[model samples]
Target: MIDFYFSKDQGVKVTTVNWRIHKLAQEGVITRISRGEFTLGSGISYSPSLSNKQISLYRKLKTEFPFLSICIWDTSIINEFMLHQPGRFYNLVEVEKEGMESLFYFLKGKNMSVYLDPSPELIRRYLSDEKDPWIVKLLITESPTQEVNGINTVTLEKILVDIFCDELLFDAQQGSEMDRIFKEAFEKYAISESKMLRYASRRRKKQELEIYLNDISKYRQQPNFIANK
Candidate 1:
């Protein structure tokens, strides 16, 4: 007999181990991908970085939204800011959802954007909040009409609004982070006060709109700021 579960001081006969592996293979949980090499079946894939539970959740989400494009933000940022855990989560962005199923699917799991770059705990907390499901759904589905450096990014103004919205829904720390991002985006991207105002107007977030407008107004003396608008 060989130990199957070491902590339990339990051992399984070779026949038992073979039977279990065979049953799992039959059920498509495991497969022989190549000669002498075993692999997870169609329902599974190997991700040395993710835990079994995380992999299962990822597969389920992928199965539910086959058409959605998936991206993972830098794990270090997520660990430092969002989860505070040294790992990553799938950030699913869908551009073709026409119903509630997509939203429901995302809501069932913790989702974040490359922009949020929050810690895992924060991501989980945000997902669990009853008032934020629609907000998160909108964030996932919303796409920029353009891409920057080969990665899709929301417009600077829209990003600002997202941060402000997060602030409104959560706490000051999130809001400050959004403010920092807004400032950084303005410096790096071709953002204009008019464009920012337009985006804010479309969202009907008047207060945040006014705040951005004021920020731009104060910076009008700067040449880059003038050139941008």
Candidate 2:
């Protein structure tokens, strides 16, 4: 683990240290494994490294709204879990509730393919064939995320929760495909069920999701699979 210490002789304030830590995390110089804790190495996980354009947009928006939480990721990441591949992928930008409207308008005025919490109808009408459609939504509470290459992106846990709960938004990753995703994700990455369940509880789906996950575990012939892993 990378331990961060503040020194008074160097005249570093707590806020300065905090900002620097966030900066280093954004640049992948360090990794935030949990709240107020960091470690070295890339570690096994699912997190997208944003493209330059995506990072630039995030930086600009963050500067405009410093206190707002933001997360961006490409839909291409979902292709791995999709049985029927989507022709065009989207760039989703999720922001805090209070900043959603303002940011959406600002991005729209700038001629970006920006939309505010697109519905299934709107997605089919405008975003289906568009190249890199930028969809913005209000960030859900307790959503898990990771910073990669100076930008915040959704973590695997968040992705799994979304795939399970959001049928409209993540329609492509359903039924048997959902099973495949869960199986592949657990096998390929080191997932924290505690973190996932905490976030799912915030979404009010913890019990049901837990039941579903347990069923999947039993089906896989690995009872108490996730917690044990």
Give me the candidate number with maximum lDDT: 2
Give one digit per residue, the lDDT tens place, for model 1 in 196-218: 55555555766667766576455
The lDDT, on a scale of 0 to 1, for candidate 2 is: 0.75
TM-score of each: 0.40, 0.74
lDDT of 2 by residue, 10-125 (tens): 56666777787788779876566666545433436666656888889889998988899999888678777566786777788988898899999989989987889988899778
Report the error of model 1 at residue 68, Å: 7.9
**Per-prediction RMSD in angstroms?**
23.2, 11.5
lDDT of each: 0.42, 0.75
- Cα deviation of 171 in candidate 1 (Å)? 3.8
lDDT of 1: 0.42
Clash count (model 1, backbone only):
7
The TM-score obtained by model 2 is 0.74
